[model samples]
Target: MTGFVELARAAQAARQARPQVPLALATLVQVDGSSYRQPGARMLVDAEGRVLAGAISGGCLEGDVAARAAEVCASGRAARLMYDLRADLETIWGFGAKCDGIAHLLLEPLTDWRWMAQAEAVRGRRLGGAVVTLLDSHGGGATCALLDGDPSPAKWHVLHDDARLLSLPELLPLAHSTMRTGHALLHTVADEMTVFIEPLVPAIALHCVGASRGAEAIARIAHTMGWQVTILDHRPALLDELDLPEGVMRRRVRQLEAVHSALAELPHDARSAVVLLSHIFDVDSAWMTATLPLPLGYVGVLGSRKRAGQLVEHAEGVLAARGTPLTARLRHKLYAPIGLDLGGESPASIALAAIAEIEAVMHARPAGFLRERQSPIHSRTPSPRVLERDQAPTLPEVPLRCELPEHPAE
Candidate 1:
């Protein structure tokens, strides 16, 4: 079972044990600045406003969410809360504390079995789709099904004032977290006024190709991040050495044929990320040869530049013979010299950098040092905007001074 499945099960158990208590489910539907949970991150809050499962933010924000959850449970109404740390004193006092960047949370009282049933059904099918429509917002309610389909709406449920037709092709590639605003429309897709369709699938996956020290660290880090980690290695000794948890799957294979066979058996999805950290170049070559062409979220390989280049060259020839053109984007996605520029030689440090790079790639971000970059450390801008309307101003270049400020002569 996945981490989410376990969380659901635990929440169910808690609910059963305390039948009298009402449960409020709070999910971090979207994040604007640096926050702990990403989009679709969920946490179960009991009637007493206690956390039963999941994390929505770092320790700084959970207490406030829990308190609000109590109020939500007391009243049967759903609340769309935006937590911003940069708010003025009045807003901060009203919202409890400022979180700096905005974190949009959907807190709904879980009194109906139907909502839980829908979640359970999605979990059983392992299908990823979002329920888009604001419960309290101004937009009309309409659910968009995101399963692989033609550019047409499939099933229509409850109708509201603002009906908008959206082609699935136009919506899939765009980030799912963003929403637009507009009036009701029936024909063409609108760029504005659409509630985001949030998928139920976890946006993180751990793909381990070799059971080396690096692989072990990767698995551990991914587990902490609530990702589903799958370990595939040819050496039984490597698996035995790691002493991984029961949740992690260990696949034993000798050749690329075995690896391909194993991957073919499993269902491939956008949320999955594949990492090949095997010391054996042949095994790495075989895995890369099989995975690179597939539409994977992220593919990382552990090796030096020279070694990765050689493997890629061989793989390209192999793929070319099969009539599959290896693109440049796919090549860059396959990090031969895996990990960020952390200048680490140790296996553990290398693993940290590799996992960091994987997360950065998953989020479509640059894996650079935050201190070195001039941009806001945590803020994300969806669109560029002019800061001022006037002409561009130039400042005189100032010389750097190493000495301390001199005392003024009084």
Candidate 2:
């Protein structure tokens, strides 16, 4: 989400500036092995070989991709650039990086700005969506980005429409699967043309229920990571006194009665997380009880193990009285002694540990050292290889139109 945001902001600025230098969009369509970035990663480059925004690799492939972008802009045609990173690390062409993989990128001229508008529109909705890109053949480099409830009847907004690509009945199913599973898929249509289906989910939102120094620390770190941060407190003075970044939001609510309404107005999706740092027993208790029934992914309380247990017990009694049961699923969402066991007593160290834990839990990963893990650092599910038509299961049909727009000959 952060990568895409950077790319979008840069591209939008470039468009508004109306630069004389032509621009190109580099989409990392596929990866054959372990790499710093996965498929669906993108970078925007200019005719002068400057990287405007985003990154395809950890500085290894950007230089080469930027050079290719110059050619793509000049020719006015999309070019498929492939890099074999499995060579010697010390070689001059290797960029001294140890990325032993194959990266395939689709470099296209950024003549059509409608795709940019569509991307911004979908993002503004704060919902999940899938982007389908035609990678080589059948209007290669055409992209269709639509949100969950787009009003436009046409499913795709691209350079031009291609009849052959539209005839492929399996395209829509593959895209639906990508959105449902929240995983990117590199697919081959009829064993000839290639397409990439990538999912776009909203950024993680961190809700700080207190305006203390600890909350300020967490908000600073979260803002740097591009997560939405909101600081809330019953006392408006504390919120005003706390120094926070520009985009961070501040809200003041009256005690228990307003807690429910305040939380209801904020993000309540699985991507949202709430942390109780008020240090006030009654305040934390009221917030905990209010958040239990919501669909938030993580709910952390800053206190000792004993205090956490006591809050849960109190929440249970309150919920039982209101005829709402504290189910196991809801209990699993609570992290009583908030944050990871990073061995820290200071507010700064404690904030670091909490943010790290939230990231791990949100991704459903075990918070442990990379050296101790045996499996790949990133999950390589749905194989990067060309998915066979019969091999990939057909997900249920959806309203999405996966038509590939034809890239008109220059």
Candidate 3:
């Protein structure tokens, strides 16, 4: 979502700088089997044929899309370009496409204020919304509308391409569905309008439940990736000592029970994760007991397989003592010994492995090597939790700052 917003901002700026030069946005709206880029991926092009912001494919389709975008800018109309790489062994556009897939791109000249409005929507809006582009308009001539789903009508001021409002109350119902499915749908509304509704949700949140060394790595990397990270710990001393990157929220709690209310109050969805990195049995046990009931996207504990089983037993014991029954859902959602087998003993490698697990879960992807997976290298449907254009927040990547402590000298 942020990436699209950035493109919007860039588009607006480019338009402002040259006022006369036209710019167009080509969005990869739909994809068939074996696409390098999935639906919701975007690429921006200008009248001068320069690619900006996003890419629709791995250097295979951008040239053609950019040419189409140049045509859209020159013609001042919206257009859709369909590419079928699997059609034949050789053809124009470089003697057969490499992806062996099909993609539908909605290319529209960004001449109106709607792009700027989307940029603003990405700025502060959090409730999640969608932009319903009337692709049938065939480019600049068609209408684009934005309906922010988070707030009521007061905050969600609709904008149309022609500077006049169109009564699209029917879109309100679709907004709910878009947010739920986290995918843009090409729907035929009243008056035979074909609008692509793309949902915009909040960034993924990772609530780290300890200030251990592993916790620092998680916070730093997740923060760099634009995830909303909240470092929660009972020990103020340890929490303060953690050198997390900017945008990481630090919460100081006084007891194990404090986490319950904290977790309850957090704004989370299926993309959120709660990772236990306290490294202490009592602390981890208390957190697991408290977290197992919450409907988080992931509940991970850092430990060995045997330790993971033991922790589950401890959590069940703790919950049973309180007469709380652990649900099967907890078993399904929890990733004990959190993270993938990246096989690095260093702190940074461990952190990478842990985040990789969360990423896989968020995308409903199995954690395995690409060579081992027979399916396409890129998954077509991202995690339903991810909104259109919602990449990491706009922040510089954080450098690896963690220095693992040396083992005791012989």
| TM-scores of the models, in the order given | 0.70, 0.87, 0.78
Per-residue lDDT over 1-410 for candidate 2, one digit per residue giving the tens place of the 0 to 100 score: 36656776777677677568888888888888888898888888888888989888888778778887777788888888777777634463734566678888888888654555456456546665666677656345555444333222245443334323533246545655666566788877653766677777667889999899999999999999988899999999999999899899999987778998998789888889999999888999999999988999999999999999999999999999999889999999999899999998999999999999999999999999999999988767873433353233444434334443543332
The residue-level lDDT of candidate 3 at 149 comes to: 49
Residue pairs clashing in model 3 are: 1-389, 1-390, 1-391, 77-139, 78-138, 78-139, 78-140
Clashing pairs in 1: 85-98, 85-99, 85-100, 130-198, 180-193, 181-193, 182-193
Candidate 2 clash pair list: 160-406
TM-score (C-alpha, index-matched) for candidate 2: 0.87
Per residue, candidate 3 scores C-alpha lDDT tens digits across 65-135 of: 77666677777777877778686325545476555677777887776534444534453346676665665
> Residues 121-226, candidate 1, lDDT per residue (tens digit)?
4433544333444333432222223222111124222222222343333433331222111111112134444344444454365778888878888887777676
TM-score result, candidate 3: 0.78
What residue runs in model 1 are displaced by over 4 Å at the alpha carbon?
1-7, 27-41, 55-57, 80-84, 87-106, 113-127, 137-196, 267-270, 374-410
- What's model 3's lDDT at 351? 91
lDDT of 1 at 113: 29
Clashes of each: 7, 1, 7
